[model samples]
Target chain A: MKLKNEQEQKVKAGRYGKNFGGQYVPETLMTELEKVNKVFNELKDDAAFKAELHELLNNYANRPSLLYYAKNMTEDLGGAKIYLKREDLNHTGAHKINNVIGQVLLAKHLGKKRLICETGAGQHGVATATIATLMGMECEVFMGEEDTKRQRLNVYRMNLLGAKVKAVTTGSRVLKDAVNAALQDWASRSEDTFYVMGSAVGPAPFPEMVKHFQSVISKESKKQLQEQAGRLPDMVVACVGGGSNAIGSFAAYIQDPTVKLVGVEAAGKGVQTDKTAATIERGTVGIFHGMKSMFMQNEDGQINPVYSISAGLDYPGVGPEHAALAECNRAQYVGITDDEAVAAFDYIAKEEGIVAAIESCHAVAYVQKIAPTMAKDQIIICTLSGRGDKDVASIAKYKGVQIDE
Target chain B: MSNLAQIFKNQKVFIPFIVADDPDFETTVKNITALAKGGADIVELGIPFSDPVADGAVIQQADLRAFEAGVTTQTVFEIVAAARKETDVPLVFLTYLNIVFKYGYARFLKKCQQLGVSGLVIPDLPYENRDEIVPLAAKYDVDIIPLITPTSGQRIQKIAKAASGFIYVVSSVGITGERDSFFAGLSNLVAEIKEYTDVPTAIGFGIHTAQQAAEMAKIADGVIIGSAIVDIVAKEKTNAPQALEKYTQEICTALRTKVEQ
Candidate 1:
C-alpha cells in the first residue's frame, strides 16, 4: 500500500527515509514483512500499548535519564563545557534495552509466538532475550561462533533467561555470519517468528522502528540539558558501531544544524591497517546486512573482516543513516586508535570513578582530545552508553596490564 | 558446426562445466587447456554472483573464496576472452540476471556474441522476463538454454518449446549439492522432458559420481556436473590441470561405457 502524502513525507524526511528503509530481502519473507508492518502500524495508535510502555519506562527503565553537567572535568582545561547523558543508568546497563523493550512489545502486539535476533557484542541479544522471557515469549539468538566464545558470559546470561543461542559458523564467523543465519532461520519460519533486528540497520521498518525506539534518548537528553543549563548543548558525541546510541541521542537534535554531532569509531592499530572498522574515515559505500552503508570491502563486493579490541565496534558496516549523515556533513566522525581508547579507559576509571565499556571509551577518548580546546561555556553532551563490565579483561590485555577492580 | 543443435545432432559431444574465475585465473586457463586435451566438445563456465540462492554450501564457499581472491564479472569475461585462443570448445557462459542487467542486456549479449560464446544458462530468467533478450539473442545466434525442473509441470513443455540448443532438467528440487544418487529419478525426468521437444536434454545440478554419470549417459545426451567438478578444481594444493583431466576422463569413460551398452 502507498503511504499517504503527509505520512510519506514525514517518514521520508527523517534521517534514513523510506528510500533507504524497507525490505530488500528474498521473496520468502515478503508476506511476513507485510504482516509485521501492518500489525506495527495498527498498534501505533493503541493507547494500551503506549500506556504499558510509559509505565515500564517510568518504573522499570528509569525514564528521562539525567544529563549531568561535568563541571569538574569541564573546568580542568576548559574549552567547551561537557555534559554527560547518563544512558548507562538505564535498566540492563545501556540504551540497548530501550530498543529491545519496544521491539519485544511489538512482537507481542503482532501475536508472534517466538522472537529471533543476531548480536555481536551480545549486549543487544541479552537485552532482547531478557525482554522476551519477561513477556513469556520464546526467544532464540544466532551469534557468531567466534563472538559466542569471546562473549561467553553474555551467552550464559541469555541462556539463563530461557533463550536458545545458536553459534553461526559461516563467512568470517562474525556479525555478518550471524545475520545470515538469522535471515535463513526467519525465512524458514516467518509465519510465527519475529526477527528482532538489534541495531538501526537491516531492511525497512527495522531501521525506522529501531530509530524510533532509540529516539527517546535524544528527546530526554534535550529536555534534561535544557533544564540544567537553560540552553541546548552545542554538540553531542557518541560511539558508532551499528550507530544506535549515536542515532538515538542525536535524532531529536538533528534538525538543529548548529548542534555538532560527532561519532567516534574504534580505529584499531590505525586507519591504514586492516584492523580498523571506522566506516566514515576508512570505508566506502556498499550494501551489507540489507542496508546501503559504508563498508570495509574489497572490489569483489565481499566484506573484509574487521578487527577491534572492542567486539562491539568490530563490524564491517555502519548504519545507513550514519552514512547519509556523513555524506551531508551533519555529523563529523573521528577515529580513535586502540592505544588511545585504552588510555581513555584508564583515565575515565581513575578520574570519573566510572568504569565504561571499551566501546564507550572511544567517545570518552574523543572528548579528552577536543575538550581542552573549546570555550568554557560551550556545552557538549557525551552519551555514556554502557558500563565497562564486559570489557574489563580485554582492556587489561590491551594495556599489558591487569586490573583487580 | 554452425549451431549447438547442428553440432550435437552429428557428433557425440562433451560439455565441461568450469566456474568463471575458478581456482584463480592462471589455473582456470590451465584447466581449460586440460579440458581441451581431454577432448571436451563444449565448455559451460559459470560466473559467481553475491546471492547465488540456487547454489548449496560448497559452491557458495567456492564463490566466496574466489571473490575474496579478486575474481569479478569483468574478470570472468577476461578469462573467457583469454581462453578462446586455447580451445575450440563452444563456450557456454552461465550467469545470473544481475550480471547482464549490470552490463546492460543488449551490450552483454553483443559482447558474448563478439567473444564467440555459444550459449547461456540464466536459471532464474523465466519466460515472462525473456521477451526483451530472446529476440536479440536469436539475432546474434546465441542459444538461450532454459531449464525444466522436476517441479515444472506443463511449464516443461513451454520451456522446451521456448528453449534452443539443449534443455536442462534439474535432477532435484534443491540447488547444486553433491549426493550419492546424483542421477536418482534423472532417467524418468529426462524421458518426461524428451516427449515435449526434440531438443537434446542435458541433466545438471548433481551428476557428480562416475556411476551416476554413466547411468545418466545411458538415457540423456549430455551430463553437466558443476559444483563437484568446481570443488575438485578449486582445492588450493592440487594441480588443477591434473584434477580436471582425471575427473573428465572418469566421466567420459563412464559415458562411453553407457554408450557401448
Candidate 2:
C-alpha cells in the first residue's frame, strides 16, 4: 500500500467526517506524530503486520472474548435482551490492553526505544507497562496524584510490570493534568520515545489508530451475536471517557444504521453540578489535549476541573470522534450519576455474578434505566470495559464497607 | 510605520515576556513600564491560561499564581490597557488558542486593537489551522505571528510566506525554559526561514542571560526572552517590576552588539 503525504493524512484523521479533527499540536511534536502516522498507514495494509498483530492479540491478550447473554437481567427487565461483550475477561483485565498491544508493536516496528503514556484509572498504564515489559522497552507512565491514591492497586500493578509511574500534581490533579505532563515528557524526548496515547483522543492519528486497534471488540461481538442470538443487536452501548471502548465497540456497527449507538458519561453529582465529566451533554466545542472536541470549560476557555466516582471517566474533554458522532446524531450520549453507577455496580454483581469497573458501571446504569422501555425481542450489547477488582477498595469505601487499603 | 516594523527597524529588537497579573494586575502594569524603560523594543504580555502545554515549569507556575490572584481575560486586557497609557512599546499577547477561542476571536482581536496591542503569539495555533483565527486578526490589524521550530523542516517556507510582523524561531525542541545549550542546527533553521520571507525572525525559548541573547542575535533579527523574565517575576514577588527591568537592560545591551564581519 502506498502511503499518502502528511497533508492528505491530516485531512482524513485531523477532524470528523467534515470538520472537528486536526493535529493542533506544537511544531516540535509534529514530525514524530507524522512519522508514526506514516508507518501506521503502511502497516495497516501490510499483510505481515496484520498477521503478527493478530497473533499477538490472540496468543497473548486473548481476543474473541465471550459474548455472554444476561438472561436473568433480560428476564428481570422484561424488555430488551442484554448481552455483555466480555472485554473484562481479556489479559490485563480490560479492553485497554487491546489498543496497548497494537501501539507497543507499532512502536517496536518504528524502532522507538521508550514508551510513554498517561492513564486515569491505571488500566491503560498497566496495559502499556505489560506490553513494554514483554517488548523490552523502557516504560514511563504519568498518572494523576488523586487517581494514584484511588487506584493504588493498579499503580502497584504497573510498578510490578517494571514501569515508572510519575504522579502529576499540577492543575486539577486528574486525567487532564496527566495528559499535560505526558505531552511535556514527549516534547523533550520525542526522538526516541513513542507516546502510546491511551484513548481515541489527542491529535489526528491517535483517534483513528486506537479505534482501529479496539475495533476487535465489536468485530468479534458482531460475529458472536449472529451465531448466538441468530441476529444483530438493536443497540450497542459503552462508557465514554476519552471514548476508546465506545468507539471500538461502535466501529463495526457504525455503518449498520439499524444498530443504535449509545455512549454513557460520568455525571459525578449531576450534569447540572460542576462535579461532572459528562462532556457531550454539558460541554462546548473547544481545543484541548491536541484535538478540537467538546470540553467542559469556562467562558475564559480554561478546562474545568471535572469529577466522577470512576477516575477513568474524570476527563474534561471527550474524543473528537465522539463529539462528531454526537453532532451527527449517530450516537446518543447520556449522563449517569455516581450514585446510580454505584447501585448498578452492586446490581450487576448480584444479578449476573459479574463485577464491573465503576467506569463500565456507567454504561450498565444507563442500560438498567432504558432496557425496560424497549421491546422484549430487541437486544442491547454493552462493552464491559474492565474488571472491578481494581475498584473494590474505592467502592467499598463508597458503600461505607470500611476496607483498609 | 506599524508598531512591529518600527520596533525591528533600527537595531536588533529585544522583547521581554511576562504573565499579566502574576502577583497582581498592578505589578504587571508596573513591569510593562519597567520593561519598556529597560530598552525592550517590544513586550509580549501573556494572559494566564489553565493549561499552558507549550510552556515549561516556570511559566506554568506563573500562570497558576496569576489565576490564584483572580486574573481573568477581562483583567488581563484591562492591565494591558493600563500599560498602554504608560508606554508606546509594542505589546503582543502570548497566549493559548483556547483563550482567544473562548473570548471570541473577533472580539478578542478588537479588544487588542482597542488596547493598542500590536500582535498575537499563540503557540498552539499552527500554520495549518491559522485560517480559523487569522482572518479576524487581519481585520483588526493585529498580526498573528508565525513560529518556526528546529523540526519544522520544509514547512518553514510555507509558514514564513504567510508570516506577519515577524517569525518566532523556537531555539530548542521542547517547551519554554532556560537551557545551557541549544540545538546545533538553530542557525540553519533561522537561515532557512529567511530565504522564504524578509520578515524579521526573532529567536526565542531557552534564551537566558546577556551572552545567550548576543549569541542568538548574531543569527536572527531579534531575541525574545520569556521564561527567564517570568522566573524573575515568580521570585521577586512585589519587587518583580524593578528586578525584571534590571535584567532586561543587561540582555538588551548585549543584544545590540554588532556581529564581527
Candidate that would win on lDDT: 2
Tens-digit lDDT string for candidate 1 (A343-394): 8888878877778878888998999989887887788899988877777766
Regions of candidate 2 where Cα sits further than 4 Å from its true position: A1-13, B1-3, B258-261
Predicted candidate 2, C-alpha RMSD: 2.9
Candidate 1 chain B, which ten residues in sequence have the lowest lDDT sum?
A: B123-132
Residue lDDT tens for model 2, B1-261: 135866677799998999999989899999999999999989999998898999998999999999989999999988988888899888899998889988989999999888889799998888888999888788888999988888888788889999888889999988999999999998899888878888898999999889999999999999999999999998899898889889988987788755532
Runs with alpha carbons beyond 4 Å of true place in candidate 1: A1-23, A402-405, B1-18, B26-56, B64-74, B83-261
C-alpha positional error of residue B237 in candidate 1 after TM-score superposition, expressed in Å? 9.0
Clashing pairs in 1: A22-A204, A79-A374, A79-A375, A80-A374, A356-A388
**How big a share of the true inter-chain contacts is recovered in candidate 2?**
0.73
